[model samples]
Target: MPHHLIRKLEHFTKLSCDDRQVLGAVASKRRTFAEHSDIIEEGNDPSHVNLILEGWACRYKQLDDGRRQIISFFVPGDLCDTHIYILREMDHSIAALTPVKVAEISRASLDRLMDEHSRVTKALWWDSLVGVAIQREWTVNLGQRTAIERLGHLFCELFLRLRGVGLTEGDSCALPLTQMELADALGLSNVHINRTLQELRRAGLIVLKGGCLTIPDLAALQKASLFNPNYLHLDREGRNLDANEPASD
Candidate 1:
């Protein structure tokens, strides 16, 4: 094992080398999922918790009537099953939105980490709470924001999250999202998404070309989304953006 997973954890919390190795002991590379692959079937017992090492995925719930609603999307360094432990059976299905690399951390591994270091366990649990808060924020956005605001908030989220993983630079990044995907995330029609994107461009906030985001004004963009870091629970041993971003260069 490359033990690269520990690198992500090293920044978020204060783990001793031994503790780091212990956690790494349980982490192993998972099978890669192709774009649109069904990762976990709804109503199935989740067998293991997975940490995203690469790419994007979405969790969604479907109704008997055939309507589907996306609940959350996982980015790099986000736990694919951080909340799945409490799930006796998955209520929703997860799908890879792009080629995705995951790391499987078995339940036994999680139990061992929790037993060895309570702080590590607490930090991981806090991640789940933050996940809930994000879903709540999305609900508020969908209920109140205009299509433009909704889209802006989604963009803000992408920038911040990618920043968290040290993947952003000078207000620009490779953002491979289609208009239809944006529409699904924002609960709007594709036409509405296209119109809002144009409005964002007109405002000198953002531009999309060649599947890349050119954010001319990151500060203004964050303001538009009411983006807040408090919900992210920055106390983890690793994945600390502030502690990592400035040093990334």
Candidate 2:
């Protein structure tokens, strides 16, 4: 299996060989979940943090009437919620969108790893910072972007995230989300979501078929979506960690 966490961390800082081995060892004891199954339910006490190894999942909350709002999507190399053990119970639920594999790291083990590895600890902190940045971007996306721009921004974000974990090929990637799932994430009705996708397709911006998305012109799509990748914090070095304008490709 790919050392996705290591690869993700290396983007911020290089890890020594020993650090890589330690991360791999700590991420053992993998398990799988079926599609639509809750990995961690709301109000449940979480004793372990999960690292995604395969497939996709989402953090979501349900309304009294059973309407769901997806808070965020989790792809390979994502930490479901680090340090969640500090809380008495989960505030939201994490459910698998596809057949998913995850490695559960116990609180004790995580604490030990942090204590023993300064560089690894710093890398994890950087990872947490990026998570916060993404949440802020999502808030902006919901509050400001139009339906078409909202969906387009989402596609760009996913493409980059998947590319970070080596899940993308060239300009295309597997986008296994259904229209209903997209609607929930974007806070739009299914009809609106479908219409927005059609608009993007008709504009010669994207090719989404068979659960895959291909952006023919990434720069054009970025402009159409009004997307700025500054929130992603993907700089090779830790300098300029704060959000800024998107970097030139």
Candidate 3:
């Protein structure tokens, strides 16, 4: 049913049965990628939009020195590249963090869906805007926050995002990244990442084990990290519009 995509879209605005049906069609074609494999390379001309259905992927860029920086994480229901057809070539690469399943929607299919489904189009726009906001938040996390704060903020954000998609159980969610991967994402050394993780555990703020992350006290973690949810734009938008009608009205 592509409920993950529906749940995510409805977070922005309600979706009708038809909206849900079309979204299901959007996810009809599925592709799988092995863990640590690049879903799309940095310089390749993107042909289709990839929507995550299961597992995780990350957008990252590699420097000439071989250092990699993870720009963003894509969970289920997240689009890897929605309007990337406009670009001549990809600016960054996306890699699977686990055995990942994705829906590959071609440009023609996407355009037809948007042309026919106004609500879906608007929801997509909301999703795109939130992506930009998240990038900005990551920038602040890297440039301004301390190591502990950076890690804490990331956890809080991931927990809420997973919970929103009904992928989280209680205060916990699947976090399959290795310590080295976390180091790459957070711009820290492996040793530094390990130390910061220990500190978080000692503080009784988080419990990360067995490829899963659990927050015992979300509010306390948010405080320590100076985390804010406003950037996610998770609040339901366009409430005045009818779910079954076109969003343009």
Most TM-score-accurate candidate: 3
lDDT per residue as tens, model 2, 136-185: 99998899999999999999999998887788899999999999999999
Candidate rank order under lDDT: 3, 2, 1
Q: Model 1: how far is 3 from its true place, Å?
A: 8.3
lDDT for position 102 in model 2: 97
Counting clashing residue pairs in each candidate, in order, gives 8, 0, 0
Q: Which stretches of model 2 miss by more than 4 angstroms? A: 238-249
Model 1: per-residue lDDT, tens digit, 164-196?
Answer: 657788788768777877777778888988888
lDDT of each: 0.73, 0.89, 0.90
TM, every model: 0.86, 0.94, 0.95
C-alpha RMSD values across all candidates: 4.4, 5.2, 2.2
Ranking by TM-score: 3, 2, 1
Clash tally for model 2? 0
